[model samples]
Target: MALSVVMPLDISGESAKYPALFEKMGVDFTARRCTTPEEVVVLARDADAIITEGSQCPIPREVIENLNRCRIIAGTQIGYDTFDILAAAERGILVTNVPGYCVEEVSDHAMALILACARQVVALNEAAKRGEWGFGPHSSHIREVIRARMDALGGKTLGILGFGAIGRSLAPKARAFRMRVLASDPFVDAPVGQEAGVEMVDWPTLLRESDFISIHAALTPETRHVFDENAFASLKPTCCLVNT
Candidate 1:
């Protein structure tokens, strides 16, 4: 019998990459369109292995009960808090994910967001297009933009919400800018956080102290919507939040 493989990404031989990869691996596989969390269970119920980019669909202990043939689940991207690994391990299901799969692209995107925020890219571009230069006699139009920053990244604290691969990846870059990094990850040991030159702190302490906070956390039941109203309200008013 062929090994049954189910991928949660919508696939087509014409443009999709997986078909060719499976053919190369000499494995039997199927891909389905699963955009919603609800659609996951109905389609993944019988899958021997699930290769997915999205993981919101909870793979609870019950799903393990239902999946006898399933041996492994491979997440296409970095985070897989959607998969209950502890439960899966109890049931002997191997879970894997591609780490920092698109490192350059992701870092580039984050840096771009930070720079755009610093350079007033949106406002200046819009003004330039309309033939509007500095309205004030001496760089006055940019005064409002100046208010947004009031301070640059240097000498500012950058609190990284998670000390996983992505957070560690950004640390040196943030440090290079002469910014202090404070990291909070329940799973991270004090030694590791210290090795990164980031002081280990509680979530509330990190949020309150940071001038620029970047979220690099994996979404878990505990972490989903973790940055809700109360969390945001706790941040310093001058702080900026960046999500990736």
Candidate 2:
């Protein structure tokens, strides 16, 4: 009998490609649009392997304990936080995830947002749409545009909350615009920050010093609500924050 594989997520438009791919690998593949732990238990109980699609389709401890034959659980996304790793370990089932997924794309998007905020791009675009052409000094809307006051990125400070892969990738990009970069992460050392041309600082220092702050931290208990009311109050009045 061929080994069975089950995917417990609604893969949407990518449904057609999975069966052919699995068949070529000599495995019996089944895709279920499972959105709950009960659904996962029913669909993957007897499978040899399971594939998941990040936190959206959680495979909790209950589901892991119910699996009678599953030997591996592979996550298609970068984070496997939703998986019951301890339960899988007890059952001798390997848990894995794609760590390099979207590193560049996420950093690029963060940079785009930083630029937009510095230039007041959205506000200016909205003003233009309202027939407020404020380019010329004599235009009636010139005063409004002057009040918009776009700041230059050069000589500004950018603080990165998590100095992991995506944060490292964003450092040089910010440097190209002549922005000073600071980073804070317990896992990353000062040498790594120096190598990336960024200052290694504490979280409070990063919050107080940055003109623009970007968050690249993983979603976990410790990282959640990091920017609470106190943190918000610490930021400069003109500071811009981006998370993408």
Candidate 3:
């Protein structure tokens, strides 16, 4: 019997990206878009493996309990919060995700957001469009207000929560701007941050000392709502936060 691989999401358009590889491995592949848990359970009943987009649809415990032969559940994205890993593991199903796939792109995006906030790019652009050029007397007050809110990246501290691939990638970029980088990740050792030219600090220290905080942690029981009202209160009043 041929090995069966089923996609419970609509990836027909992306089939060409992997069909030849699956064929080379002598595996049977099927792509079907499933909108509901019942649809996923029915379509994946006999699948040896299930490929999922993960973000659009969730593979709940109920769906996992009903799968007859699925040995593995693979997600296309780094975060797999949409899937019930505990339930899948109880059923002897392996769960996997693609990490570091868009590390550079995401890191760059984080930096862009940080710069935009630091420079007050959006507000300044809008002010310009409103004919409030800084040369005018009234515009001078606007300039002062904007300038009061903006700060240079140099000599500032950047805190990264979760020193994973994207966070590591972002550290060097922040350093390039002459900012001090602090990282907090209980799962990672201190040397990892030291090697990346970042200081490994506790969550509270990172929150209180940082001029900006970037969140790159995965969503899990321990991490979910880690940044709550209390967390926000710990931040410097001038601190900017960018979530990716």
Number of the top-ranking candidate, with lDDT as the measure = 3
Q: Give the residue spans of candidate 1 off by over 4 A.
A: 12-17, 36-46, 55-68, 84-92, 135-141, 145-150
TM-score of each: 0.77, 0.89, 0.89
lDDT for each residue of candidate 3 in 38-119, tens digit (9 for 90 to 100): 9988888888999887887789999999988889999888999999999999999999999967999999999999999999
Ranking by TM-score: 3, 2, 1
Clashes of each: 0, 0, 0
Residue 187 lDDT, candidate 3, scale 0-100: 90
Superposed Cα deviation of residue 199, candidate 3 (Å): 1.1
- Taken over the whole model, the C-alpha lDDT of each candidate is 0.75, 0.89, 0.90
lDDT of 2 by residue, 1-244 (tens): 8999999866566556888999999999998788778998999999999988866788889999999999999988777778878999999999999888889999999999999988888877776777776566444554665355688999999999999889999999999999999999989999999988999999999999999999998887898899999999999998999988
Give Cα distance to truth, residue 33, candidate 3, Å.
Answer: 2.9
The residue-by-residue lDDT of candidate 1 on 1-244, one tens digit each, is 6667877666654328777777788778777677665565666676778776644344556565667678888777687777778878987889898887776566556656665665667777775676655665544555656445644678778888888887887887888888889999999998998898888899999988988888888787888998889998999887778887
